[model samples]
Target: MKLYKVDAIVLRSREMRDADRILTLLSRQKGKIKAVAHGVNKPSSRKRGAVQPFCYSSFLLYRGRELDSVNQCEGIEAFSGLRADLDRISYASYLAELTDSASMEDQIDGEAFFLLLTILHLISRDGADVELLTRSFEIRLLDIAGLRPHLDNCVGCGVPVESETVGFSSSTGGVVCGRCSGIAGDVKFFPRGTVEILKLLLKWDLKKTERIKVPPRVRQQLRQIMQNYISYHLEKKLATALFLEKLYYHY
Candidate 1:
């Protein structure tokens, strides 16, 4: 069998028979890959820490008939800081889960992979508001996935949406003007500022993101809108998302 080496981020892991694990990883060149790490769960195993969820590691994968086997792994950035706190850990899991759900095998998404690594690094080093970071990640993920909403113009009519109250059409993939919203069923209305905040979050980097503040109400609204958008496009609920929300709000 051929051996391949690449930089990868551990997206998720499931226990195998005993000490082994099935890892879902996102690699720089390979996109998403499912590999089994033999004997990784043992206390004395060298690969124990390397295969943990949210870890960025350099891996040597041996090709297998179905799934590749992770022969060797060396930690690049374990992102230990994210695991230091429950909130951070939960948020990191949410990001990893989203990436895993959105990505496909054999499709190289270098930009998305880099963005995920950068966001994890940022969360590890400089602490961010969990809510803001999660929302920002969701927006950026949608943008990267080519599902970014049309905030500047109406989805139905080709007019600039300048109304105080704007409506979003999940089916149409963006905001529709008050006039055009009537045609779309179950259209949700948002204050103009809310849409602007969503746009700003989409446009700015995490460093500059702190400059804008979203009120709790608006934040909640944006979260719901993003959740709807993601669910619509991905056509499934993110299992980790609810857990993160509960963890974030409960403690």
Candidate 2:
């Protein structure tokens, strides 16, 4: 077997028989990898805390025909703050789930990996608004996936969309002017301010995001729009997303 090393973020993990764990990692050089960590669950295991979810580590893996085996993993950053808070942990799970769903094995995406790590770090340390962060992540994820909707001009007319009431076409990939929106019966109208908010999210970095004030109602609307858009693109509802939504409402 050949040995390799890569920087990875733990996307998910499942317990195996005895003290082993099967980890689904999103790697910087390799898009996604499944590896077995023997004895990780044991109290004396050296890899105990290093293999936890949301952790960024440098892993030495031995390639196998069935699945890779983790020879060694040295913790780089555990993102401890995320694990300390329930809300942050839930949000991080949602982000990880989306990344895992969007990626394929053997594909390298350093940009996406960097984005996920940066967002995770922000959520961990910054007392940022979870809803806004979630929405921003959704938009940015779509943008990275090349699924970002057209916002500057009407999807149909190619004219600049300047109306206070704008129609968003998930199918068309952006805003459509009223004149052109009639062709799509399912298109939803959004306040211009909501449109502006979405644009701000797309343009700003995670740290600058806190400066923008979004009203509760506007935030709710944006949330619905992003959730619907993401679901339509992914073609399935995310389990972690549903859990996060429930947590949001319960708290």
Candidate 3:
């Protein structure tokens, strides 16, 4: 077995037999890896702090033929603020879920790795807007995964969308002009406000999203657009969405 080192963030973890845990990690060197961090559930285990979800750490791993084993881990950053609030946790879980679903095994996405790290840092800080961070991460991750939605001209008729309203076509995988929108069954229109937001999100870096203000109506519009865009591509329900619904809209 080859011993290798990687810097990664624990995305998710589930308890296993004998106080061990199976970790889903997004590694900087190796992309995504699942390794058994043995004995983490035990109180005396040194790996306890570093193996929890959202913990960023450097790991020494023993690479086997099929699955790897975590030999040692050194703690880096644990965003404890997520533990202090339900809303932050909800957004963090959604971010983790989206990253986990989009990532592939052994594909090194250094951009994506650092993107998650940056967002985690933003989430940990005081006065961070959860919606803004979440939306920024969503758009950036979509870009890294090569699922970037076209925000330039119309995807259908190749005309510039100069109207006050436009349609987002998941079928065309971008914006559709008003004239060609009705030709597709999956087109959804958004106002000029949401259209501008999409354009800004597509072009802005995540670090520049701090002072950006989005109204409640714009937030709702962006959420629906993101939901439709993701659902059109993934075609499956994200497990964290249910939790988010329970926390925010439901009692």
How does each model score on TM-score?
0.95, 0.94, 0.95
Off by over 4 Å in 2: none
**Per-model lDDT:** 0.87, 0.86, 0.86
Residue pairs in candidate 3 whose N, alpha carbon or C atoms collide under 3 angstroms: none
Ranking of candidates on TM-score, top first: 3, 1, 2
Tens-digit per-residue lDDT, 33-56, candidate 3: 999998899999999999988989
Worst 10 residues of 3 by lDDT: 242-251
Q: How would you encode candidate 2's per-residue C-alpha lDDT over 1-251 as one tens digit per residue?
A: 39999999999989987899999998998878999999999999999888999999999999999999999999999988888788889889999999888887778888788888888878887567766877888888788878887889998989999999999977667789989988676699999989889998987878777888988889877977787777878889999989977877542
lDDT of 1 by residue, 23-112 (tens): 999999889999999999899999999899999999999999999999999999998888878878888888999999998887889988
Worst 10 residues of 1 by lDDT: 242-251
What C-alpha lDDT does candidate 2 achieve relative to the native structure?
Answer: 0.86
Off by over 4 Å in 1: 249-251
Query: Model 3: runs farther than 4 Å from truth?
Result: 249-251
Candidate 3: lDDT over CA atoms?
0.86
Model 2: ten consecutive residues of lowest lDDT: 242-251
